[model samples]
Target: SNRFSYSMNLKGASMTIDTACSSSLVCTHVSKLHLRYKDNEIMPASVVNGLNLMLFPGPFVGCCAAGMLSHEGRCFTFNSTADGYARGELCGALLFKAKQFNPADGGLCCLAGSQTNQDGRSASLTAPNGPAQEKCIAAVLKEVGLTPTEVDCIECHGTGTSLGDP
Candidate 1:
């Protein structure tokens, strides 16, 4: 209710989506489509934000989870050793609009698309399949006509589990 009135100004030109961990990423993908294919009709400037709060104490009983919070103590981003300390946080935010702002306004940091899928068999609500991981990578490559060798680094999901690592 806090931001609904503000959202009304966005109208049919805007959208609100919730995809848990991948929420912001999903928004970026859509914005890219709008920019590349629908720019003539839609001015593609957009603002994206995410927030994570680690409040469920019961979920980590007897677990030694470790993670770092943002300098302001608000998020746990890309920290290598991040554990259950990972919450639905202010994960990130982006301000972008197709053709609305020129790159020189501020250096243009290029945006790329991502593909996300479920493993289906969440055997323990955490376990993920290696084949699924491998396939997801392959699917992205096929869509973009690129190979793994061309990519530099990968931001991994460090849920403090070896199984989840793969």
Candidate 2:
């Protein structure tokens, strides 16, 4: 079973942040909020993703499992003989300015808004809870005054495991 993976460096706009699965996405949200604040003026339309890998399994196991390896010399995206996603490691850098640079200095990436929720239930210890998931997402939509229909994308943590889907 594959267990580890790696990626190279990436670019950023104003500041580089690191979170777990929500890191890259959170950074993007914050950037938008900064733009709304009108502290800076630079905000790129598109952003780039950084290298991120996930490894380690013990307390629990989901539907997804894999690994990473360095064979001869080249780097691999997803090898053929690989099993599942070893460990999930992801890094993302975005282009954005701050809401306030130096008090007198203006032109920062004003944050428009952001939303966050949680999966309250943790089945055994590392399992995902559905009710909690629904509540969190619902809260975000309510805060934004939008409906689920307005959501265009969903970056999920399915893990390709039976538990994740079934």
Candidate 3:
């Protein structure tokens, strides 16, 4: 993060978040909040990055032991026969800016809002609570003064497991 900031000449606050599967989304959520919380003079923009790399076999072995790796070696999310999710690596970043700073080209797209929630009573660590997830989405839409129909897209965090996929 520091290296990227140095290269880009960004001096605002920067940090890393490691919440496993939801790390990227969590980073995005935080960035959205930061863009909204601070004034233009302080921080009118923010950058969020997430990387999942398996440089070693420790995590692979651990997930295998915990039966978190799919036997078919593929992710069958939302499927009834899903055993687990397929593990992989990804590196991505997103730039978030305040509405007032929108470029003349209109930029890529606008991030209306973001929200995070946890399922304390989930069946397992990787399991997703449908109700909790629904509540979180509802809250975000309501906070943004929009209904379900107005939503253009929803990037979700899926685990491939039967309970986790939903």
Question: Could you tell me the TM-score of candidate 3?
Answer: 0.87
lDDT of 2 by residue, 1-166 (tens): 0111113332224454566446666666765655555434344243434565545554124322222222322333234432223344455455444434343544334333456555544665445687777877776677668787877666555433333433
> Residue-wise lDDT of candidate 1 within 58-163, one digit each (tens)?
5344343322222233333344433333334355666666654457878466654466677786575556677887888788778778888988766555443334
Off by over 4 Å in 1: 1-16, 37-40, 53-91, 99-105
Prediction-by-prediction clash tally? 12, 47, 0
Flag regions of model 3 displaced more than 4 Å.
Answer: 100-103, 121-124
Write candidate 3's Cα lDDT for 19-134 as tens digits. Answer: 87778888888888877887767887788888888899999999899888889999887777778888888887777777654558568777777899888877777666679888
C-alpha lDDT values of all predictions? 0.56, 0.48, 0.81
Which ten residues in a row are the worst by lDDT in model 1? 66-75
Q: Which candidate, 1 or 2, has the higher lDDT?
A: 1
Q: What range of 10 consecutive residues in model 3 has the weakest lDDT sum?
A: 157-166
